[model samples]
Structure formats: C-alpha cells, structure tokens
Target chain A: MNGLKVIETQDLTKVYGEEVAVDRLNININEGEVFGFLGPNGAGKTTTLLMLLGLSEPTSGKARVCGFDPTREPLQVKRLVGYLPENVGFYDDMNAVQNLLYISRLNGIPDDLAGIKIKELLKVVDLEVDPRKKVGEYSRGMRQRLGIAEVLIKDPQVVFLDEPTLGLDPDGSLQMLDLIRSLSQDKKITVFFSSHLLDQVQKISHRVGIMIKGQMVAVGRIEDLAKEKFGVGQEKYTLEEVYMKYFKEGLL
Target chain B: MKGITTICRKELADHFSSTRFILLFYLILMVSLVTAFIVGSGLRDELKDVAKPTFVFLMLFTSPGKLFSLIQFIAIFGPLLGIVLGFDAVNRERSARTLSKLVSQPIYRDSVINGKFLAGLITISIMLVSIVLIISGLGLLLIGVVPGPEEISRLFIYLVISIFYIAFWLGISILFSVGFRSVATSALAAIACWIFFSFFVAMGASVMADAISPVDQARASLNPELLIKHEQTRKIISLVSPMTLYSEATTIILDPLRKTTQSILLMGPMERLSISRFQSPLPLSESVYIVFPHLISLMAITLVCFATSYTVFMRQEVRST
Candidate 1:
C-alpha cells in the first residue's frame, strides 16, 4: 500500500452464502495507467470491482482507493473515482444533458463548471446528437456512451469502466475504444476498465491482470507476461491464447 | 445540498416524464368527474322530492353530508395511488443497474430516499388538489351555489388529511421497495399489504369482536331494528382499521359544522321492567379531538416506514451487476 497506487486490495474476499465469489484477491493499480481487468464470466472481476468501489462489503481483508479505505471512507474514495456500471442505465426519461447534469450535481461539482464539463464530456463521447432526446429512445450504444459521459462529468482521478463495450456494435465498439483511449491519454486519467475482450484490452491497456476462479492469476505488462510466462516467444501470443493456455495448464 | 437537489430534480423529472403519471391523472380525473356527476344527479332527485325547494345556497352548504358517502370511495383508492407510484421507486434502480452508479457518487444514500419520498408526496398532493378543484367546480356549477368560507376551510382540512393518509401508503411502498429486489415483488407486497390493512383487517377485527362480545343474539333479535342496531356495532369494530381512521378523519373535516343535538327515548329492561337510554351525537369539533390520536398514529407510522427505508438504503450494496 503506497500513495503512488490508486487502488490496492490485500487478501480481499467476498463470500455469498457458501460460495466464494471473490477469494483472497490482491491487486495494485498505479496512477495514470490503463489497467485492464480481464476475466471470464463469473471470474469475480465484477465482484472485485464492487468491493473496490465500496459498493459491496468484503467478507475479510482490506481494500483502498486513493489511499482511503473504501469500506470505511467510501464517500471520500468515491469523490476521487468515477465508475461506469456494466448495464449503465440512466433515468430513461431524461436526455443525455439532463442525465449528465444530474450526475455532475450528485458528485458535488460546482454549478458553473458542471455545465461546461457536461458539454465537454458529451462532445468527447460524441453524444452531440440531440441532447434533448430522452434516453429511453437512445440505442444501447448511445446509452453506454452517455453512461461514460456521466462518469467523466466530475473529472475524477480514476475512472472504472465495467465491460463498457459489451453490447455495442462493431462501429460503436471501435468508437468507444477510441474514446476510452483518448480520455486516458489526453486527460491523464487513470483508467481501470474490466472486459472479457482480450484483443481490446491488449490494444488499450498499459498492464493487464487476468483473473480466473476468484484469483488474480497473472498481472504485468501484456507483452512481458505473454513472453515471460506463456513462452509463446519471439512471435506475439494473443491475450486470448495466453488466457486459454493458462486455463488449459490449470495454472490459475 | 447539490447532491440532494440533484436527486430531487432527477426524481421529479422521472415522475413527470413517465406514462404512469399521465395514466394516474386521467384515472383520478375520470373517477372524480363520474363521482361528481352521479352525486349531482342524486342531489337533484332529492331536491325534487322536497316539499319546498329551499335556497340553493342552503343545499350547497349541506352538500357535504351527501358528499360524505364518496369519502369511502376516495379513501379506498387514494392510498392505492401512493402505493402504486412508490412500489418500484427503489427496485427499479437496482433492476436497471443504476443503483451502483448513484451510490458511487459522493452523495449520502439518505438523499436518494428523501428525494424519492418528497417527489411521491408532491405528486400525490398535486393529484389531490386537482381532484378537489374538479369536485368543487362541479359543486358550484351544478348546484349553482358556492360553498361558504367555513365549508371551503373544511375541504382544505380534508385535503391535508387525505395527503397525510396517502403519505402513509407511500411510506409502506418505499419500505417494500427497499426490502425487495424485484419490482414485481415489491409491488405485489405493497398491494397485498394495502388490501390487508384497508379491508381484511377491518373484517378480521369485526369477526373477533363478534366472537368476543357478550351480546346475546337471540334476545337482541326480538326487534328487527335491534338486529340492525347490533349490526351497526360492526362498524365501530371496523373503525380499528387504519382506513377507517382516515375515513373518519375525512368525515370530521368535511362535516366540521355538524351540530350534536339529539333527543332519544330508548326502552330497556329495568328491574325486569322498563328503563330508557337517550344519547346525542358528539359535536364535530369534539369528534375531531377524539380521532386525533389515530391521526397521529397514522402519521407516525408513515414517518417510521420512511425512516426504515432510509436506513436500509444507507446500508444497501449498490453493485451494478
């Protein structure tokens, strides 16, 4: 646990009844880095994120975001982080601008800055098509973009995106990926995004952690981990191959 | 302050933008209008039968007496509106996976619950005002007489009391919404609870009272009217219901000027012979005082439910998945 790290989890565990949803997970994510959290379905990626976001209580151990204990100082931690949820729903009756404005206000952004920030964020997400159109009428990809725009409104130090590209079309997915990359690079924002898409994670992430069966099995630079651990050597091993090899060898 | 205001604005927008509000508004409008028409027609028929046509002003002044019957109708559905509007309030956020997004903000969870409660309260108040205006307008137009200041004051009191009554149901709905994960489950729970409190509880109380009371049915049936009077005892028993408390409160408000003057001559057994029992109706003011405890209880229960929801929401996990 150092000040340089934006997120640190030590032996963090979450149990639902007799099932261990997340077990003894340890992670450290540095500031201003695009950290990809790659995991299969039910691999505890979401559960871990929930704990880090202070949205769920861990059964045991410690987790901190921005040097504040998430469970104890959730509000303090929340003030420094922005989270885009998996489904990313807004009040469907509200338009993009209204939704962003509401989220900005909730995050305690000052009145004057909130308007300017909303406009900038909306434009950045390419959601400049009628701001007055109700969100219910928005396509899945548009809602996702609006959700991303909402998370960015407060201009927090860290932004967490959970499967942000899960439901998008190919064009929307590409656009979203570009937007996420640009947001991190241009704004110097620490991006901690989770996804099952290995190729996307490989393309965008500074470092990637692959989680399997409630444990962080691999964590390092994508290229270094592929070359050092998998030994697919000289030629690049796609993240999917690395994921498959690790699971096949039961290394996870 | 900003967080609270944000929640409030979002909740208000959602309330107004949803088709549910439009449907509820129309339903209430149609119900009130139909009620006004039926009652107006009945009053017209009653006037025709009178030996002498009194001044229309006197008839309008006394209109509350006839309008009191509609109290049952309004009381039955008023809380229904509150429950329906509020049942999905919290659950929808969870279902849509928005709860986590909202909670992840720096805002306190209490603000979400408070904003929602306020929005529901405001919506119900608006609906009540619209219904009252419609009823009052129809009264003035068809009866061709405006209500007196005292009558209007009573109507305002009735409106306030009705709002409080509906608030009770709103609180219950919020409680259900917090307690249940599924919107359908919350709604079903709220509606079921409403039915139990509104109707079943009263019936249950009457049945229990009938079994517990020491009245001998055979002797009481000597006079057919005595049987009818004994049945009236059931009404007193049913007053234990919360719905009855609200209905009685409305009755007091609507008939605030009712006088308690009566001459009764009753025959009963006295030393195996005759004894007389006579009683007069209590004045409306005194009746209001009597029901004050029940009104307070209803309001307290509403606050308690709301407080429970707030606490539950504060502790809730807002995981988006």
Candidate 2:
C-alpha cells in the first residue's frame, strides 16, 4: 500500500474446457517496482501475463492495469502497458530500425517522433551500432535486447516480460538484468517479469510473487517471504529455496 | 482503426520487400506482358482487313491464336497470387512468435486480421492495376489502338470484379491461417481449397447436373425444357465455387455478348431457338445489370470468408510458446 497500484486482479480465472489454466488468482503490483513472477513450467505464469495484457480473456473475474479494466477497456490497458513475450520475434526481412519503427507505428507514434524515439531506444538497448542489420542475422542475445527496446517504444507506464532471459549467455543475462534494473530506477517504469531463473530474479526484483498450479502461493519482499516461510531466527534461504518450497507444497 | 492502417503499412512493406513477393510479382508481370504482346501482334493483322470497335477493345484480353487470353490467365492465376500473399499472413506471425507481440499492442484483436486482409487486397489491386497499365501501354505501342470510352468503362468494371475475386481467395487463405496453428498446415489447407474450387467443383457440378436432369439421346440437340433444367442445376451448383461467379461476371463484362438472364425460347414443340438468336451485345449498364447477381454472390462469398477469419482471430488465444 506504500505505492499506487498499477496492476490489480480479483478472483481472475481462466479455464480451458476441463483444464484450469489459471484459477481465481488475486494479486496487486505497485507502480515503479520490479515485480518478479516466479513459477515452474506450465504454472500459468504466461497465461496470467496474457490475461493482464488483454491478449487472452479470462473466463471470469476482474483484472485492471493502469486503472482500466483489461476486459472492458483492453485497448486502454494495452496502450499504457508494454509486453515482451518469451522468444520475441521480428520480421526477418526488416532491419533493426525498421522493426522498431513498425512497432512504434502500431502504438500510434508518428513518423518523426517514431524515428527519434527508435534511435534513442536502440541506443538504450545498445543496438544502435548496427541498426540497419536484418533481424534474421541477429543473435539470440541481440534479439532479446531488441525485444527490450520494442517494449519501450511506446513509453508505456507498465511493462511485462515473460521469461525475457530464457535463452541467453551469462553475459547476455547480466546485460538484460542491468536493463531491467535501469527501467525501474532510471525510467521509473513498473516492471513485471516471469522467469525460472531464481538467481537473476533475486538480483533485480524488489518484490516477487510465486505461483503454482494456477494460484499465487506467496507474494511479498524476499526478506519478508523468507521470514514467514522459515522462522525469523532460522537460516536465511535464497529465493530458489523459497520458490521450491511453495512449488512442492502446491503439489500436495 | 489507425491500428489497421499501421498493420497494413507494415504488412505491405513486408510483402513488397520479401523475395517471395518479388518473384511472384515478376512472374505475373512477365507472363501477362508476354501474353499481351502475342495478342497485340495478332490484332495487328486482323485490324488491316476489317475494323471492329468492340473487337479492338476485346482483342487485348481475348486470345489471338489457340493460347488462352489475358483474362483467362488472370482468372486462373489470381487465386495463386492471393494465396501466396495471405496463406502465411497470420500463422507466420504466430510461428515466428510475433503474433503475441503484435496483438499485445494497444489495438483491437480485429485490427490484426483486418489489416492483413486489407494489405493483401491492396497488394492485389496494385498488381492488377500495373498489369492493366502495362498491357494498355504495350497495346498502344504495338497495335496503335487506344480503347474507347466504353472500353475504358468496361475495363474498370472488369478490374473491380477481379479485385473482388482475388479478395475472396485472400479471405479463404486468411481464414485458414487464423484457424490453423502451423504455417505449413494453413498453407496446405488453402491450396487444397483452391484446387477444390478451381477444378474439382466444376467437374462435380457437371456430374451432378447430368444426374439431376438426364439428357435424352433421341434428339441431336438439347430441347428448351431440358436445357433450362440443366442450366438451373448448373447455376445452383456453381454458386458454391467463387471461381464460377468470377468467371461468369468477367465474361459478361469483357465480352458484352453474354448476358446473365438468358432463357430458352421454343417457337414450336420440336424447334428450339439457338444462342445466336440473342447474340446482340448489350451496353455497359445493361451488362452490369445482367451480371449483377454474380457480382453480389462474389461479394457475399468474400464477405463470409472475411467474417469467419475475423471471428476466429478475435477469439484466438495467444500463447508464449
């Protein structure tokens, strides 16, 4: 409650026929904070991100981003929120600048403004050196960096990263973490990302939410979560240990 | 709505720059120009003996030798161009993992499909218009005959009809792209549909027409009553294939000799009037009215296919995988 709520969900649910992909998830993320969403594979992490972005509709319940209901005012929510999907893709035929320009246009940025913003973003993500290179020739790490630039193209208030560092070298991962950190501290933008990389999440995230089997089991600061799960005087376990404990408990 | 234009602009750039589009564009342009050249050469010889107003205009599209006319080539290959542009329109984005990124933008879900569909149609229009201009230019150079006002009006109608025809195929291709997950699967489905409508439907309709009303061998010629029944069956069956509607409309527009509402007249019980009896060419307005139903049917089929794609796309869920 210290900061204004940028993202809120109440009993948000998504079911696919007999399978419940996301079930009655309730969570709130404050503004200008790096919120790490941690879960194992098929834990409904991506599903939740999609629902919040208004890319996929929830079966029932309500969710809001930037004070707009995602289902009712999806376009409004999407305008203020940027989402970088896992395994980000670009039109291979287009150069780096062209790809970013294309995205900027989709977000309703004019040509002159888009050009200036794209150059700035490319510089921000360190892709300005070879802005004219076709994306087909880009490496995994370069593409991930470009993906970050794409999310920032519209100057969104809130950004979602679904496993942004899923496939990258150690160097690439570190660079990505630096970029995410700068997004919160320098740009004052809300960052919500899901990842299985506990070490990376622990380093950058101020607060983390752990989900398992379509439900949020834990949400708080790492220190507070550790104190609550293990006794206050007990050994200080890392996010990896804390995440595994909730995931295993959810199995039962 | 601005999202539609943005997506369309991007899609157009992609289509215009891609090697696949370039190859198809050149192939279509080269083949069409070559066809026009051959027709122009033949018309040069015919124009010397007799001067026919309609013949001069029609000769550009009509065949000179045994080769198929320019219109026939378009009627056959237009769907291929449409399928090429649209088969991977949506699925490629999905497979490339760009669909989620594009949809996650501030645009409505319908915009993506609309933009892609609109882009394909625009590309089709560009191709068709260029070919027309090139042929007309070549005709003026080779045969020294400029189309009259009537010819220009007819040609414009023909162009509009061609757009609708290709748009119908584009719709079908996009529909497959929206329905299927894999790019290859959607492409295969679109090609299968093209073949079914292009060739198989005609053959099937013929068989069904023959079965529906059998022709007696006792008479050398088809009687008025039996011809009417067969024609009715054929019309009803051909309505299922968009190609039929397109070809029918184009023939009426281009030839001006054929009419849509043709009925057999039997002066006596044993004697039936021939098609030559009604061989007088109608004016442009009358021809349009005659082929009005075919035009409407073509538009209806295209709209239905587009509506299906729009619905499926809006309902489709985006997965990060």
Candidate 3:
C-alpha cells in the first residue's frame, strides 16, 4: 500500500485437471520495484507468469496486471507488459533485426519509428553482430541478449523474465544480470524475474517472494525475511539458507 | 486483422526462402515444363487436318506428356507442396520456445494460425499460377495455336481448383501441427495422410464396392445392370479422398469432351441401341456445373481442417515448455 500497486493477484489459482499448479496465491508487486520470484522447478513460477501475461487462464480468482485484468483486457495488458521466456526462441532463418521487425509490426509499431528504435535497442543490448547474420548463427549468449532487446521493443512498463539466465555461462550470466539491473534502475521498469539461482536473485531484487508447493511461503525484503526466520537477533541469512529453510519445511 | 497480415507476411517470407520450398518448387516446375514440351511436340507432329481436335491447347494438360498427364502429376505431387509448407508451422514455434513470446504480444491468439493459413494459400496460388502460365506459354511456342477466350477461362478455373486442392493439404498439415507438439510426429502424420489419400483410398474403394455390389461374371452377357451398380459404388467411395475429387473435378473442367465419369455399363438400353452416338464437347458452364459438387466437397474439407486448427491454437495454453 506504500507504493502504487502495479500487479495484484487476489486468491489467484490455476488447476490442470486434478493438479493444482498455483493454489490460491496472492501477492502485490509495486511500481519501479525489482521483485525476484524464487522457486524451484515445478513451483508454479511459470504458471503464475502465464496467468499474469494472459497466455493461460486461471482456474479461479482474479489477477490484475498494470491495473488491467489479464483475462478480460489481455490486449491492453499485453501492450504494457514485456515477457522474456526461458531459453527464448527466435526465427532461426531470420536475422535479429528482421525478427525484431516482425515483432514490432505485430505490436503495431510504425515502420519509421520501429527502424530507429530497433537500431537503438540493439546497441542498448550490446549485440554488435552483422545485421544480415541469421539468428541461427548467433551464440547462446547473443540470442539471450536479443531476447532482452525483443522485450524492450514495445517500451513496456513491466517485464517478466522467466529464468533468463538458465543456460548462460558465468560471463553471460553477469552480462545478463547487468542488463536486468539496468532495466529497473535506468528505465524505471518494474522487473519480476524468476530464478532458482539464489545468489543472482539476491544481487538485484529489492524484495523477494518465495513460493513452495503452489503457495507463497514468504514475501518481504531479505532482512525482514531473515529476522522473521532466525528471530530478531540475526543480522541476515543468505538467500540460499532462507530458501533451504522454507524448502525443508514445505517438504515436511 | 493487422496481426494476421503481419504474421502472414513473415510466414510468406520464410516459406519463399526455405530450402524445402525451393526444392519442391523447382522439382514441380522442371517436371511440369518437360511434360508440356513433350506433349506439345506430340501435338505439333500429328496431322492437324486428320481428326482435328477441338481444343488442342487444352491437350497440354490432359495428354500423355510422358508417363502421366500434367493434372495426374499434380494429383500425386501437389499435396507435398502444401504438406511441406504447413506440417511444422505451429509445432516448430512450440519446440523452439517462440510460441510464448509470439502469443504474448498484443495480437489476438487466433492471429497466429489464421495468418499462417492465409500465407500458405497465397504461396499455393503463386506457385500454381506461375506453373500454369509457363505451360501455356510453352504450349503456344511448341504447338502453333492460340487459346480462345473459353480455353483461357477453362485454364483459369483449372488453376483455381488446383490451388484449392493443394490448400486442402495445407490445412491438414497445419491441423496436425496444431494438434501435435513434436514437429516430426506432425510431419509423419501429414505424410501418412497424403499416402493414404493418394494410394490407399482407391484400393479401399475397390474393396468396398466389391462388397456393396458384386459382379457376377457367371451370368455372361445376360445382365450389364449388376456391373453398372458395382462401378457406381466404386466411384462414390473414391470421392472420399480429396485427391480423387481434385482429379475428377479437373478432368471435366479441362476436357469438356469427357461426358461421364461412370463406366459404359450404365449406358441406357435405348441410347445403346442407337447406331451413332456422336461425340461433342459440352460448354464450359456445363463442365463447371457438373463438377460443382466436387468443388464443394473439396472446399468443405479444407475449411474443416483450417477451422479445427484455428480452434485448437486459440484454446491452447501458451506455455514456455
């Protein structure tokens, strides 16, 4: 309630037949805040992102993204939110510029504006390859950089990156983390990035939300979460320890 | 609608540049032109004055160019054009992890499938039209005869029908792409369908007809009525395949002299008794009217395919995995 609530889910739930992928989850993400969503595999991180982006419908409850209900006004919501999926893909035969151009057209950006924007965005992502080189020729790191550029094409207010650093090397991961940090710092874009890499998430996020078994087990700044767990006397607990703490409890 | 056009343009560009499309296109063009050349030479050498054929121009398509007629070649190979274009249309995006990024854009979900189908139909039109035009030009050069307005219109109709026939296959491949997640699985399923329609339908139809209306060879010349029933049953069952429908429809469309698809067993006793049953080609209108039912069936199946894919794609969850 202290800041403008850009994303709010009220008892949001998603079910696949008998399986509950996300169970009555409720969380609020504020404007201009880098919120790291932490979870292991099959912890409903992607299912939650899909619902927020209107790519998948929720089984029950309501969720609003940028104050727009994703189910009812998906186009409006989509226009304002960018998403970079895990191991993002591009048309292998087309060059980065061409692929971005296609996405630009899909977003209804005019040719004149899109041309200038693409050049600038490519530079911003530091992808200095040949414009004619097909994406198939790109290295994995370059493709991931292009994914970031692809996300920024529409100048979205918020970006949801689902494990953007999954397959990158140490150097690539550092570069990716920098680009993600810059997105929130310079562009004032609210970034909700999900990752199991506890160290990486700890470096950039102002606040973190931990989910276990389709439920939000903890949500707060690192200090507050540490204090609540170890009871007031501890200075802090590493994100690894905190994740382990809840993970063990959830298993039991 | 803009989303549909944007996606369509991208898909068309991709298809035109793809190696598979280029190879299939060249194969079709070379085979078709060679067939026209052979047929044209045969027509030119024949005595024009002796047994003059009405539409010598139309013979470029229906004549025994080499092993089979041009229409027959298309009947066998044209579906490959559509299948190759569409078999991986949706599944490729899924496997590559692009479906999530694509549907996340501001466009409606149906735009992806609609645009792909439209792009496929356009590509089919372009390929078929070019082939038809090149053959017509070759016919003019090889056989010194100009196609009349009616002949031109008949060629035009044949081109339209050919586009729709191949489009039916495109729809099928796309339907498989939407239904199956694996590109190889969808492609295999599509090729299997093509094989069944191209070869097995005829074999199945023959077997079914034999069971429906048996022919009694023991009766000798006493009754041709039983033979007629058997032939009619075979034709009806063959109609199940789009390949059969396309071939039969184009047969009458290109050759008006072809009076009936049924066997001579169905000839009425009164007509058979006549000494002279003079042969004359029907008008173009009559030919189209005769094949109107076939065209309807071809179009209906194509729509069914595209509609099924469209619904499935829209309903599918745009997941990352």
Candidate 4:
C-alpha cells in the first residue's frame, strides 16, 4: 500500500443520492508510470479523480495518494499530488507568472524558489513566450499548456490530468501528448490521465483502465488484454478496435 | 495559516486593483469631503454661540443640514461598498472555475472563507480609517480647529463602529456569495437585505410600536410610563437593524449634550457627574460603557453573519461548481 504505488484505492466509491458516480473503485497506480483512465461521458472518470485529489469524499472506503490517506491526511496528500481539472481556469486579469505565483504560494513554495521553478516550468510547457500577457488573452491551447505548468508548480510526486487534451486541435493535442510523455520520462513523475480518445491513450499510457457505468471493466497492458480476451489476431489490432470490442454493446 | 495569508493577499490585491472598488471609494471620499466643508462653514457660525472649542471638533461629524451628516451618509451608503466588494467573493471564483483548483491545493478547506473574510475586514478598516483622516484633516484646514484628546478618541471609536457596521454587511454578502451559485443573484440578495434593514426596518419598527403600545394622548403630560414604553418598544423592534445601533452609539459619542434617556430622573452615573449639559464632553471610557450594548450588538451581528458564511463555505461541495 505504501511502496512502488503512488495511488491506491480500496473500495473507493462515490454516490450522489440515487446515482452511483463511482462504484467500489479499486485502482493502483505505480510511481513513474503513465496511467490512462478511459471512459465515456458520465462514466465517473471525473468523480474518481475528484476523490483521488481529496476534493470530494467517497461515500464509502478510502484512497491514498503518495502514501497519505486523502480523506484523513488530505493536506499531506495534496502536497505531493497535483491536479489539472477539465477545462482548467485562471484569473483572467492575472498574467501567467501571477497565476503560477499564486499557486506556488498556496503550496508554500518560497518566493525566490517559486520564481525560479515557475520560469523553468513555463519554459518546459512552452508557455514562456509571453508570460506578462493576461490569461484572458491566451488561446485555448495556451491555457492548457499554462495549466500544465500550474500542475507542476510544486514538483509533485503524482499528477492528475482530467481530459487535458480536451477542446484542443490535432496539433495542440500532439504537443500536449509530448509534454505529458516527458513528464513521466524525464521528471519521473507519475501521470494519471483520463481521456475518451483511444488513440491518445494508446500513444502515451503504459497501462490503461477502461471504466463503464461507474465500474472498471478492463485494466492492464493493451497487448495482454487484447491477446487474452479479444482473440489470437486481435493483439495486433488498434486500441480503437479493442475499445470497440469491449464497449460496443455497453455503449448502445 | 500560510495558506490563509496567501489567499488574503491575493484577495486584497484583487479588491484594490478593481475599478469598481476604486470608483466607489472615491465617491465615498468625495461625499465625506463635501460634508466636511459644509459642516466646517456651519460650525463657524455655531462657535459664536458656544465658547467650547471641543464642541467645534465634534460638530464636524454630527452637524445636521439639508444633506445628511458624514456618519449618516456612511450608515446608508457604506454597506453598498461592502456588498459590492463581497457579493461575488465566492461565486465569482466558482463561475470562473478557480474554486476547484483552489480547494484541491494543500490548504485547509475553511482557509478560503477565513482568508476572504479577513481580507474584507481589513479593507473595511482601511476605508473607514481613510475617511476619518480625510474629514478630520479637512476640518483642521477649513475651520482651524485642533481637536482635544477626548474628541479624537471619540472619533476613533465612532470609526470602529462604522467599520463594524460595514463588515456586518460584508459578512451577509459573503454569505450570499457562498450560498448562491449565480453572482448576480448573490448581489441581488445582499442589496435586498440592505434595503430591508436600511429603510423598511425603521418603518416596520414604528408600525409595530404603534400597534403594540397605543399612545394615550389625552393624558400626555402625566404619562411618562406610556412614552417610555413606546420608545422601548420601537428600540426593541429596530434592534434587528445595525444602523439603529450605530446611530445610537454615535449620538452619545459625538454629542455630550445628548443623553441616552428622555427623562432626567433616570440619569446614569456619568450624567450625574456633569452639572450642566454642554459644559464638557463625557470621558471616553465612560461614554464607551454607556454605548457598550450598542457596540456589542453591532459586533455580535457581524460575527454571526461571518460565522454563518464560514460554515456554509466549508461544507459546500467543491465539485458542485
């Protein structure tokens, strides 16, 4: 429960009145691994991410992020875990540096250190082009990149990106994918991302978990899941085919 | 604690930088300066009738004219400043989608509310202090009056009371911000409450007093008991309004000749110490005790509003935004 795994959940569940948002979720994400949490809309992907970040409490059971219970030691968990919500927002009047400085302060990073870290992360995310410009003036792609820099402000051990490539063009998504890839490869940070795009998940995630109807239906390396259940020749099939095979009947 | 400081600093920056806040502050300042000018010229005529120089300083604040005095203006308009600043404090963050990001940080959940409320209180403090300084400086420049130590202390207390009144409005406005999802609705709610307390409460108190205690005008001269009952009933009914408490406290502090009681037979210890009405201002500590309940009630209402907002903000779902 502590070593190797950066995130571990035991029967973590979230219920909103009559609707079960997350149903007895048990997930383990190891350190330094890129994990893809795949689901259709309303499939509880955001709900699970919220619980993991300690922003929302699960109806039952618990989750630990970076060896700290999110419900009990939420501050400690938050210290080591970063989250970029779907459609991340920034203060419209503030420039990129101000927004990131605010985040670094909230994380208790010293001002001088925050300045250096923010400059570095801004360059890493390629948002250093016009750091003085207001966020309201930024394009959709630029905002997402700034969101990446924001998540990396604390140099957290784990990062959660809820549809980071959402609303992006093909070129922008490709850049986002590269930035996400470098997060795990170069920084050795655990990246847990949620997306509905099959090809995007297949390109970056080391392992993928597919959730449907508030339940995780499939999890593991793509090759293993396809070879074992989808048939002999399906191992060579694209992730889109594998996704179609598993979700075709359930989707309709 | 550090999180609270960070949030507070950011909130203060936002308030000070906003055009709305700057414009409203200037409006308040302009009106206060005008009132100071009018009171200064008027006090020049009154100084001939009264030899007490201390009375001149107090007149700068309490003089009545076609326009309301500085204190009355604040009593009416100060709440708007607080409401405008705080009406969207929480809801704006939610609408802008920054609240979820703020909550997901390492800070404690209650820190958001605490920081916001603290920042608002500080802003109110700064605004009130500046208004006091401007009016007093204007009085010095125009009327050539050097306030005595007692008068300065009284003005300081009055300034504190004004701040408490505005902060009460700030608390309720923030409460709406925390409770409502829409910023417009929250602002509307705060203004509605302000109208109710500022205008309707006084009318309601008078109507309730007349209903509960019908005056016997036939025996008017011999019925001190009836008059006291009517006054007490109106006061009890209007206790819900912070303005009533503030006005009551200011009268005792600014006008030494004005006694809290209508009858001389029920004179308190402080009133007993003075042989004449206009001889001198009451001692600062003694006058504070005279209006102690009024001050406490204003503070208590502000605290209750703040506490309610704090609770609401803490229990709210971050994901609901």
Candidate 2's residue-wise lDDT over B53-147, tens digit each?
Answer: 45476678865445888888888888989899999888888888888888888888888888999999999999999999899989889888778
TM-score of chain B of each: 0.81, 0.91, 0.96, 0.93
Off by over 4 Å in 2: B44-55, B219-224, B260-280
Candidates sorted on lDDT, descending: 3, 4, 2, 1
Ranking of predictions according to TM-score: 3, 4, 2, 1
- Highest lDDT: give the candidate number: 3
Quality of candidate 1's docking, in CAPRI categories?
A: medium
| DockQ, all candidates in order | 0.63, 0.88, 0.89, 0.85
Superposed by TM-score, candidate 4 places the C-alpha of residue B47 at a distance from the truth, in angstroms, of: 1.8
**Residue B289, model 2: Cα distance from true site in angstroms:** 1.5
Q: Where is model 1 more than 4 Å wrong at Cα? A: A1-3, A110-113, A227-236, A249-252, B30-68, B133-153, B221-240, B257-285
lDDT of 2 by residue, A175-248 (tens): 89999999999888999999989999999999999988888899999888888889896437899888888888
Q: For this target, which candidate reaches the highest TM-score against the unseen true structure?
A: 3
RMSD versus native structure for model 2: 2.6
Tell me the alpha-carbon RMSD of every candidate. Answer: 5.0, 2.6, 1.8, 2.7
Tens-place lDDT per residue, model 1, B146-245, is 6666556667777788888899899999989998999999999999988988889777866765665535768765755554454556656776566988
What TM-score, computed on C-alpha atoms, does each candidate reach? 0.83, 0.93, 0.96, 0.94
lDDT at B309 for candidate 1?
89
* Per-residue accuracy of model 4 over B28-128 as CA lDDT, tens digit each: 99999888898888877777876546667888888874588887898889999989889999999999999999998999988898999899999999999
A182: Cα error in model 3, Å = 2.3
